[model samples]
Target: MGKDLILQAGRRTITMETAAVAALEARVDDSFHRACELMLGCSGRVIVSGMGKSGHIGRKIAATLASTGTPSFFVHPGEASHGDLGMITRHDVVIAISNSGSSAEVLTLLPLLKRLGIPLISMTGKTDSPLAQSADVNLDIAVETEACPLNLAPTSSTTVTLVMGDALAVALLEARGFTAEDFAFSHPGGALGRQLLLKVADVMHAGEELPQVSPETPLSKALLEMTSKGFGMTTIVDSNGQLLGVFTDGDLRRVIDQKLELDTATMEQVMSRRPKTVSAHTLAAEALRIMEDNKITALVVEDPEHHPIGLLHMHDVLRAGVI
Candidate 1:
């Protein structure tokens, strides 16, 4: 193939991948609903099982389920006959995946899977296979053909199975009212988790580390506080600790060019009075957006009544990986 032909073939691969996922949409029926209901009804984890290529897809599906607010784990069927059958329990739900529904190792576990009193959800290309017939709910994951030239590789089958898994997981998620916060709890170190769960209060410098000054504080004194705190800005607050505004190094430079008396000028006279503030409970990523929009580097975290509680700096947001 020519270079252009090769590029067209690569694009065709994505088309095939997308079409494989799209095919599972038509299979969402009462059986799909029953499968979701069965999995949701379980008190223990969803145990995904398969062999060979399906094993790899099953692991990915289990991970998707777990991250999307469902408790799930993948167990290799071959290992189950060897000793891993102990991992299955009466309270657990088993999702057996076999493109042909006749994989020996997967078939080997079904009888014991039934003995455990666990509900079975089967994903297979053939709905009439023994595994599918035995399942409490059968999810059809058939596809048109594989991307492999001879239709021998598991490409299309794997894609449809994954899409079915995602559908089940999302359905369960919605039924349980699982919000972004719930998903974040499961993935505390992931970017999505940080964006949803990390609050200004969690990342802000609070208590003694917060650099602050009063509106009446002299410009020189405010500058000293800002320099010592290393936040590039210090909040100016009133007697009740309500934020009045902010004074920063940039403001000082402008005041100097205007020849304003640093010692005589109060921060209230030189500060940016219309400063932006965020609630301590706001997400850190949201705070980063507010800062980027306002073209400012620091924000004072305020209480519901608008009193300053902490300082959120750009450097801290960067360190937290919000950027």
Candidate 2:
């Protein structure tokens, strides 16, 4: 009705849900452990099913589990009855979500799951409901009250269900020793995947694109190389093409401050020696960290013998979405 009343309602809802989530910590007891064990031991995919709002949470839980190394997918309880039940297999495990724990559509699938000897796990608000009683392991998702002022809508209960799903996914992820690389594989199209999977060689400018000059080269020539390569820097190499140092825009400023003749200056005299370097095999994400920590824009990608093979620019990493 009024602005104060609307704000008060929103705050009250958040406060109630926050308390409900806190209560979930205590419920993560033996039952939670057993559920994780069951899912971990599943030889096939973990099948998740529910109805209405619970179904929405079930789909997210399945997605989280699948991304974190646990193979899973969501199936609507209503659809499962209409030939979709064929999707479930004897080797798989089932996680059913229903606040009342008596959803008839979900209950109908129990007999079939039992016939196949599939492990049954239930997240329910009522421990004594049929679904809970039938499950091999029951996770208590019961909340004290709904966040709705009427105490009728599935508000606090749904939030608790989603959080419980996250806890289960994270726990199983750690138990399975799932790594960031593993997650990247599951999400190859995202920025996070690029960060974790891309190597310096994959994003670095190599071959003809690398800006390099010999130590004996004039500062003017090195500056031209830096400009042509668009890297804002050029590597100084020895006769054998081994990295000796680097000349950058920053060096140009210093040379100007000293009133040196750009034409008379040599790469060896003006270059910053022993510049920071990264191997081509290094992770692009790690290379970004190196640049940020050292306050540098570029890194010389070197071979084992310190030969300049490529140039890794911060822009290159960002372009590849490593950040």
Candidate 3:
């Protein structure tokens, strides 16, 4: 085959898949809506099962549903015939995926599923197939052509089926009013989780680790506290422990330019008044945004009363996976 022919075929495959997905858009009729309703009303998890390529897609759909606030899991239809059907319960809804909708492994479990009164949702390219006819809800995933040049291999058909699954998961996700915070709870080990759920209080250095100085403290003495605290900055507070100003290396450079006596110059005299501050209750992601927008590396964590309770540096949020 010519190289250009291969390239042309590849582009054709992508076009075919796109058209298949477009066809699915119009196929989302009452049957599609009923399938979503069955899943939404299910008291137990939606069990997705299939064989071969359909099985792989089923597993992905199950995972997507689970992560998006819909309770779900995947089961192998072949395994169900061999005693795994015990995992299926009357409270659960079964979603069987097959392009032909008549795989023997799936057909073998039909009677058992019916006996248990489990509602069945069938996703298939053939509405007349056995699985769709037996199902409580049939979602027709028809495709005009296969992306496969030979027209036998599953291609555009599978792509449209997977997209349909995504549509269902997202619809359920919105119907359930799933929030970013709720999604973050399901993914607590990644940066996304930290960004949405982690608070400034969770990452800030408190008490002895916080570098603070009174407004009247000598600039030289405040620098000592800054270096010891290892934050390269110190918050200047009043006698009442309320934040008054902030002192950093930027202030140090200006203080030196003014030829000020370090022993006589107080922190308040050299500090930047009304500097950026964040509440401990704020999300760590918000702190990162503030730092990026302000071009700074550190944030003072204040309490409700505007008192500096802790210090949060860029490294702190980075280490906590907020980066």
**Backbone clash count for every predicted candidate, in the order shown:** 0, 0, 0
Which residue pairs collide in model 1, if any? none
- Score candidate 3 by lDDT: 0.91
Q: Which candidate would rank higher by lDDT, 2 or 3?
A: 2
Tens digits of per-residue lDDT, candidate 1, 1-323, equal: 79998988778877997988877788899998898889878899999999988999999999989988778999999889999999988999999999998898999988887887789999999989988998988899888888766789888788888788888888998999998888889988878878888889889998988888988898888889988988888988899888888888788889989999989999889999868889988999999999899888889888888888899998899899776
Q: After superposition, how far is residue 106 of candidate 1 from its true place, in Å?
A: 1.4
What residue pairs clash in candidate 2, if any at all?
none
Candidate 1: worst-modelled 10 consecutive residues by lDDT: 142-151
Model 1 steric clash total: 0
Write candidate 3's Cα lDDT for 1-323 as tens digits. 99999999889888889888987888778888899999989999999999999999999999999999988999999988888888889999999999998999998888999999999999988999999999998899878778887889999888988999999999999999999988989898877888999999999999999888998899889989989988889998888889998999888998899999999999878999998989988999999999999999999888888899998899989988887
| Tens-digit per-residue lDDT, 1-323, candidate 2 | 99999999999999999999999999999999999999999899999999999999999999999999999999999999999999999999999999999999999999999998999999999999999999999999999999998989999999999999999999999999999899999989988889889999998888999998998898888888988999899998888989889988999999999999989889989999889999999999999999999999999999999999999999989988887
Q: Report the poorest 10 consecutive residues by lDDT, candidate 2.
A: 215-224
Top candidate on TM-score is 3
Regions more than 4 Å wrong, model 1? 1-13
